[model samples]
Target: MKRNYNKPTQGGDVRPKKALGQHFLTDESIAARIADTLSSYKGLPVMEVGPGMGVLTKYLIASGHDVKVAEIDGESIDYLRYNYPELAGRILDADFLRLDLAAIYPDGQKFCVIGNYPYNISSQIFFHVLDYRDQVVCCSGMLQREVAERFAAAPGTKARGILSVLLQAWYDVEYLFTVDENVFNPPPKVKSGVIRMVRNGVTDLGCDERLFKSVVKTAFGQRRKTIRNSIRGMFPAGVPLPDDPLLSLRPEQLSVAQFIELTNLVGSSR
Candidate 1:
């Protein structure tokens, strides 16, 4: 079966904007796959970030879940509103990063997030996802493969850095598949990857979550240095790093649990 999505109609020319990192996805099967990945999240209010032109939105609406979209590009927003009149009040014409995530739903509403994220700001999107983990049950999206690998990379690998430890601490990250460049309208130079993140059982980090994030960022910010030397600045003046086995390893070598333990140790030192 085939579907027509965002096909330029009689007199319109909607092009991808380079400044926005908009390489519009042009493949139907991939769009369906991305939409189908959220089946387990049925009944949850769905928020699709950067819905370029309603390609995935069609399937999302057909899924019978309440769907809303946030798009920064006015042209795309105009295209969507003109084409899909059903979404009149559902579209948000604003940057996803700047939105107050807590206000996206009703009280106690847990939702799912999906998107073909802009390459440049994809990392920033994940951090926001982390910020609202309590309400985001699942997140599925497409982004640069290298970034996706960093999301799922494990300890002891070169890709295991800050994002790896921080996101994995509360979500089970899965790198679903790789998407070649040719499938998109303006094909990106690098291959794209699709990933799904399901909220894990762990709610709290058991330590200062802020401190854990600080320790991870501080250590990985200077990746070549060992934990002991890299994290010296995080400790208060005259306070030494608490004795810990992980202090001898580099940031890329420590697991999420180890990072939490290291954060607790740093807290105890002061």
Candidate 2:
């Protein structure tokens, strides 16, 4: 049975390549809700990543926001080009992860990003968002519920990890809501959650930004260990570990500011 991209599939195969993690949303209300999450960074063009069959794209366009999409699926690209002709030159026939995002928009151009993202690459997408933090002012999308929770997870929470700290340092993350598997065509095994992240007020972390990342990742590399043991290898054999009180706490217990302080301490020790 041929699947109509616009309507819900009763039971036929409506999925694109499973490798792409394509699960097209068929519920109009859910799509509209995802589109509505782009509240911040208005006036900037919106880029919809993995706009499979343009379910969410139509709502974004109707919302009067200037929209473009990065889609690598050939069939989906063809469908989008035909359905969303207003996108003319804006339908990027490229992979969102591998695209040189800085070069696509004008120099120093900022934009908002939204999507019902592919679950397989959701973490990579946010890491890419972080890499271009200066340009991507706001990001909102659907992801696996657990991953979404981690993005918006607070310090001292079990969901918090390297990304929780790294992303919190720059963006105000929020887990907006959850969606059931039945809302999608060829529903996935896990439920989904929508999230939004807007840039924060901190312009500078006041430490080696690279070292900050290293510190966060290192501290969580052995999440079961206390900070003192987790980061001990960062220093040489003779250099004593810092006597600070933070060393006693696990990485998840430290806030963003405390991580910065830890980064600075690690830098001084080196």
Candidate 3:
């Protein structure tokens, strides 16, 4: 469903394209809440992804942090430039996933990431965040409620699966709050959820991090199967299994720590 816009755009108004998955957030309170999530990290470098119509972005700029906006939509970029003239040079006309983040900020810079993320690429965004775990101190965003819940879900629950295990291994995830379906420009079918993930103290997983990720993905690839059967390919030949109860349980039953322990055992065999 495509619709016209009537904001302060440089070239008049533009239509909200469905292909871009643009659902401009209209609630000021929700925008404030999303912005305030990064209040504790004051004066730090920050970037807001997909700042459509600058709903959440205005508050991010107002927070007085060195805020740069990564927006791919040319229409929205023009609107942001016209409405927020102060964010002139800071407006990055680039896709966030393709951005050279290190080139944007000073050397050795770590920053917070906040946005009303487009639902289509939300998971990809999280994976990109993981790639820079050392530099991204915090990520607060709005996304599909189901995905947010999955991030916050505990081990042994159905929601605890691939992303749940992988992200929890490093970041401490918190499902901050839930938002209703009526807040967007074109209301989505399902409700939205806001979640915050902060970089935890654990810099290392104490095992082969790559193997740990592989084990988690492989196990969850067949959630119903026991870890032994799921990760059969992890070892070319038969290897001694770890002396842990987790091996007998399905992938959903293992916590992040348990997965790490298993990864260490499996990695030793390989």
Candidate 4:
């Protein structure tokens, strides 16, 4: 059986905007696969970010999940509304970053997030997802391959950074597959990769969550510096640093558990 998607009516193509990072996925199979990646949590609503021209949106709709989309591009919004009428009032004309995520769903209603994310703001989007981690049960999408690797990177690898530590602390990250540039309109200079993140069972990090974030950000803010040097400012003056051997390692060398341990250590000193 063939899955058919709506195309722009003759002469009505939505022009890809460089400033908006609009590289629409043109392959049907890839779109379906990306949509299907939300397997862990189902029977909940889905909010798609930057669904330019509704390529991936079509499959989400077909999969029988209630779908809403947030798109900042005026032309893409217009195209989606005109082409995908099933969305009706669910199309949002606002930027995904500024939207109040808590208000999108009813009180305690968890939803999955999927998209062919705009490369420029992809990291920002994941941060937003982290902020709403309790409500966003699953997040899966396409992004620049390097960025995807960073999300799925392990502790000892160079790709592991602030994103890897923070996101992996709460979500199980998977690097699904790689995509070629030829599959998208206005081909990107680099290949793309898709990843899925499912919220883990951790309701709390067992330390000050706020301080945990600060520690992670501060440590990786200067990746070259050893953890001891990078996070020295987090401790108050005159407080002696702990003699833990982990402090001698670089930020990329510590796992999420090590970061939590460090956070608890910092909290104890202060």
Candidate 5:
């Protein structure tokens, strides 16, 4: 089904909206390249977050994989439904962040997620994925270069932050390729990059997830401050000033394991 590119008489042209951070990707080559990255997982059901203009959707569907798309924009939904009639029922007109992904698959299997996400909520979307990491084997997305860098950054790097720690704990992140600003219909001011995150097996951290998150957040809250000072409140009975490497180092210097160790230490003392 081919979409009507011209604006409909009932609704005005839904050009890229700054509020929604909608930058429609018009470059076919880039779309194909993004689809190519998913070639290995041909039989898996793929959940695409924002299928703007059906460029990437077309490629995914053609690649012999079952494609389910979640598009928030009404105009894009109309366009997609009109253009790809076969994808009508498959396309979910709802926010990806709120949807229960595991329910979307028939066999109760996880789907590989892909999208050129809205920049405004990219971080939130990632957090959503992390919450349901068990249902996702792999994720590929187009994000602002800075955001992509954070996913693939090393523990001690400038790009490493709360996002890095959270993502790296569960996934092996890779920065694949960079995309220029000119590729979109209404080009964004900044460049974007493609990132792939493959889920690692369940970690054996042996600590409460909530406590681990709290400890990491506290440590990174005042990144420049020493761990001893930053996480003082996390331990009600007072955290022992450990002779470990973490006590002398700043938050950015500590890996996820080190942070988990700190949480375990705090939990043990309580």
Candidate 6:
């Protein structure tokens, strides 16, 4: 279905504002392609973040899915409600990060999340999704190419950091195709890419989560330092260094499994 781009009756004319990180996607083909990536799972409740002018929202609703949107921009929310009356009740005017994610779906129901996210807050939204993994089936978002690469980066790579370690612990991230800056109304400086992350339930690595987070943070806090030096104060004063094979490696060199092993060791020794 073709989207109605006319101005809304409720709100006056509003152009993309840099202050709100509003970059309206004008390319319908790119919008369709992003929609197609999430097409496999139809009939699932979809929570779209920053649905500027209902570009992707139009396609998602057209594909026979229940679509709800969380948009912070009042003008965009007005435009969406005016153009797509079907989504009037579903569209929420609130910060995506502040919304109650668990309340969006019914008991035992999982939802798919899609967005052409604001570059400024893309990482923050990813963490929100991570916090509510049980309610989410998967997530597809448009992010700056650099950020996308980090999400899909491998161990020992420079892009790998706290995000890689934390996100990889619970989700399998994939770097999809990249899109040019010209695709948006007011082009952004950096090229953007689509990223998809599917939840893989956290595994029991025999460690306290608090300790594990502390261990990972400390290890990566000084990436060049060995695990022993980086996490010196993590264990009790009298406790000896762990003999785990990974203790000799730098933070970037350790895989998720090795991080789990280190966390387990730290937890047990405490």
Global Cα lDDT for candidate 1: 0.88
Candidate 4 per-residue C-alpha lDDT over 114-224 given as tens digits, one digit per residue, 9 for 90 to 100: 999999999999999998999999999999999999999998898998899989999999999999999988999999999999999999888999999999999999999
Per-residue lDDT value at 155 in model 4:
80
- List RMSD in Å for every model shown: 4.4, 3.6, 3.5, 4.6, 3.4, 3.9
**Residue-wise C-alpha lDDT for candidate 5, range 1-270, written one tens digit per residue:** 545455443323456677788888888899999888788888788999988778898899888878989987777887777677769689898999999876776455877999998888999989998877887888998999889998888878988888888888899999999999998868999999999999898656568888888888888899889888887776666445656667778888888888888888778767
RMSD of 6: 3.9
Locate the minimum summed-lDDT window of 10 residues in model 5: 4-13
Write model 6 residue lDDT over 76-149, tens digit each, in one string: 87688678999968988899999888877757589999999899989999989987877788899798889988
What lDDT does the true structure give each of the candidates? 0.88, 0.88, 0.85, 0.90, 0.83, 0.84
Model 2 TM-score, 2 decimals: 0.93
Q: Using lDDT as the measure, what is the rank order of every candidate, best first?
A: 4, 1, 2, 3, 6, 5
Locate the minimum summed-lDDT window of 10 residues in model 1. 2-11
lDDT of 6 at 94: 90
| Per-residue lDDT of model 1, residues 1-270, tens digit only | 222445457224568899999998888899889998899888888899999878888888887768999998777877787787779899998999998878877685899999999999999999998888999999998999999999999899988878988899989999999999999889999999999999999977899988888999999999999999999987898886677778999999998888988888888877
lDDT of 2 by residue, 176-222 (tens): 99999998876999999999999988889999999999999999999
Regions of candidate 2 where Cα sits further than 4 Å from its true position: 1-15
What does candidate 4 score on TM?
Answer: 0.93
Q: How does each model score on TM-score?
A: 0.92, 0.93, 0.93, 0.93, 0.91, 0.91
lDDT, candidate 1, residue 171?
A: 95
Which ranges of candidate 1 are over 4 A from the true structure? 1-12, 236-243
Error at 139, model 5, angstroms:
0.8
Model 4 pairs whose backbones collide: none
Give candidate 2's error at residue 82 in angstroms: 1.8
In Å, residue 99's CA in model 1 sits off its true spot by 1.3
